[model samples]
Target: MACRVLEYLILPLVGAKTLIVGAKSVNYMKKNASTALRVRWSGSIRGGYSSNHGSRFYFTFDRAPCTGPAGIEAVDWTGASRNYHQHIEFEGLCNNIPAGHMQIGFNVGTLPGISWQPYLGWTTSGKPKITAEEVDLGENKGMCPHHTVFNVKQHTLATADTDSGIYGASAFRYTKLAPDTSLRVRWFGALGAKSQSPAPGCLRFYFTFNGEECKSPTPIDGAIAWLTDPIIQTRTTHSSQGDYAVALNVGQCLFGNLNQMDPDPHVNDVSRIIVEEVRLGKSQFAEQAVLLTCSFESSSICGFTQSTNDDFNWTRRSGGTSSSYTGPSSAYSGSYYMYIETSSPRVLGDTAVLYTPNLNLAGGCGRLVFRYHAYGSSLGYLRVKLYNGQHMTQQLWAYSGYSKNTWQETNVYFKQGGNFQIAFEGVRGRGVTGDIAIDAVAVFNVSSSYCNSPNRDLPKAAQQVFNLRHWNWYNLNFTGLGEIKSMIYPKISSTSGLRVSMTATVMTSQRLGPCTQWQFRFGGHVCPVPTHSVEGSRYTYSYQTTTQHLFPITVSGICTGLPAENLVLSIHTSSCGGSPAVDAVTGWQTSFFVSAEEVVLP
Candidate 1:
């Protein structure tokens, strides 16, 4: 058998503007950011040999795992921190020879791209053969998703089956990607931590990358995945064997481990999930995505009019209220998206109401109560009072500002059925009132189980479902300059602005390479501003890409302006002469927050 241990490094190269990438050789890392904790590790098996049922490779980190490919070290595998990485290739192995009879192979780790799969194989008379047929790849063993071949970059990898094991060989072909194209993007996923057992099928995965909260230096509170089950396919059907189908359960919840499963399995038990090879089928590739928007068409207009009581005469509604988009009163069918902000200072005897129609349709699951989003602290939390009229209030739910700006989705099932309603009324502080955008009000079986279990993606950790949203785009064009609306909830501290200023990530096309001539163009620049008027809060950014770095080129910029206006974020012609500049953020006052490593597309 022939095997080769190959590896690639995701170096956290310094940015022209700024960069916080860690060492390429690190395995486990723990650092205290401004307001949040940042931990990164390597889940891939350090390029190596074929072990038996007994021999294995292992590792561990001091802190938990972060998202995507992080750094890895060779030490963290001793005692207390018990994590192990193994390579069980039963096919056959030759001494570590580049061109011998037996060959062993492994990828360093993956980068942000969709095309290309990696594996181990052998070569001889110009003919290559595959091995390792008996490993149960479908099962969730020690191996995880990143180790599988299916997770390789889609551009250069293809799925090919052999008599023994499956492999996605790099067709030894070099095809140039569309310049300024992002190889991998946040097209699909549920946010936050999730479970892997008793499988819940497909977890809600989101696509758009909102800016995260920046504490002091590094940006905190962005997409940090709770990884598990990096399994790869061996034969047919969806049956998991050794480590196939690395299952990731998605839910609508918070980012913390304790925030999802009470005991927090993800927080304690596992840190990372890595698998080996994956064959990218068109269908699998297509289905590997998250939705761009939330639905609010079937909203149950469940709030008391300001007509109730006397004195303050404010509306009695406390939960799931909205100002943006349309209220439930607008549409009797289809879908709608709206935001509900909170009004403060507390008014007594102020009961809220949710209006709903019988619709008289059969197979009705009941009023799908969807609170687009909410803000404030635990004490100042927005409480949703769901009622079936008779039982009056069936639930008193709170959407905290802890998971601020992030969109959370949960389907509420009505108990007494018939025409129902969902209302919000704050007892302390100002009652929940703002553009709590509510949409995709679906009519499903109102489930009151209160999953509380967040998904591996962002959709599950959110307290309010900000549907009709977007994902981290590949090669995207911003919709021009627009206002970025803040979520009803905010993570406020004197140090960090309950928010991080956002910039656009455009995908531009320009030929680049080892010989491509380029220089920094600094002087010729125009600027726009936000209405909030917070000076010195923004930063400008730009980059250079080669033929290797395609689209999905993320561009990150800081802001010096808040409450400013008409901020036009455009890509300039690089000194290398690239074509067409695409906008990243429509410049809308987005409800979500994001701070990412911006890569200028090829």
Candidate 2:
């Protein structure tokens, strides 16, 4: 999305002279002044002026035209209400405009409250300048349309329009009114026995032109009426007879073909329009229907394909096999489920994939809902993936650990086009407990409420705040002493006031001796010790450590920082007698993460 253009004009008046200050140039005028005085102040003036009480002068500040990319506009001037002392303050303007070459123009004049000439100076103030761009404000971004796809049942009129006084017979009939016209249907019906009691209802209209059905279904309301009650002849009440008039654009209904050729060439140039109706029924426009459902109840497998990288394969089971395979006895809804079981005692890095049939998700959101079981000590992971024919695959949902032996349901949504399919993948861990199962898989085509709406990308300002959860971890494993491992963060320009917090998960075969201490250092400074610990086994222990550090790092242009900018998360175990290993066969591993955010000081 493009940035909104902001235009501002600063008008300063001194006697009869008016000074117009814009983002690009300053216009100055002097009334009743001599040609000599006008010639002296006709051109541009640079630098500050000294106080001269005898001469009356008016000043204006204007920046030159910016020579950069498009969508760059001038700074918004907040007028002269911010005048402090004798200086007219122009602050909070756009940072993109060049400030170094700003020209200040002055015109001499005489007016009241101008007994003393004001001095001007351009210098940096104590407060920090805002260098943020306008696009960072997250305004004027893309928005989705409220209604894009709808499915409504058709409705028809009860009485013929020839005898009805409201509409003619031609209005109810599907006729070609014009070359670019739409299909319109209007109907009126009686609500009760009398015309005094009103009972309103709704009607839906569907159109088909040239053997092609319309995509959008529209609904209309009935007209109001007043009818006399049969129980009390004198009592007359307001009621509604479901009366509706619907118009469907021929071009949209016929899939962009306004002038559809008639199938019967012998007939006239007019094309036939078939109409259907469903009266007094609620609109099902927003309700989405289930496009695909799989219960895994039969041996046919419901047209689902299974794949595996290794020898392990997903098996169809109707009952539990053994104690290790203590999962759902049957499927969530049926008596069968697709499960992947690893060989007992030893677990291998095995993967089993089950994919759905090719689904048509063009111009709509596809919702995949399924139930999964992942419960065991050494349980593996269950991941749901979406594959688009364009060579793009997205991981929709993933579960790694146990789920209390109960079936858990999850929903994943994605927007796709062309040919697409959803795949259920089960990764086997290193033990017999690496068993997982899936059942009750369903896919739905949800109506798009906001189709083709404008969407804005995350602004550069918000990207400065680094979340530790978002950073990818770099693992290191070793015994005895460890080297200083450094990880460089992605660089960002035009920033200052740097602060960072580091987090890590350290799993060791054994704990370091009480006397022997280990420390994590970054930027030549020792980080804080581990504050949290989780005990897994007698020889295996997991420690979570966190530490914060402030650095004087200033970045401008495309400048990369010093060695200190590259954070080093290392364990100084050489000084201690004990050895702490990371991600080794001795059951040790370490994962490091850092959260670095920029602080803009005012």
lDDT of every predicted structure (CA atoms): 0.23, 0.34
What TM-score does each of the candidates earn?
0.28, 0.30
Model 1 Cα shift for residue 242 (angstroms): 10
After superposing candidate 1 on the true structure, give the runs of residues whose Cα lies further than 4 Å from its correct spot.
Answer: 1-414, 425-602
lDDT of 2 by residue, 72-132 (tens): 1111111112111111111111123332333434333332332323322212111101122
Best-fitting candidate, measured by TM-score?
A: 2
Give the best candidate by lDDT: 2
Q: Distance from true position, residue 587, model 2, in Å?
A: 75
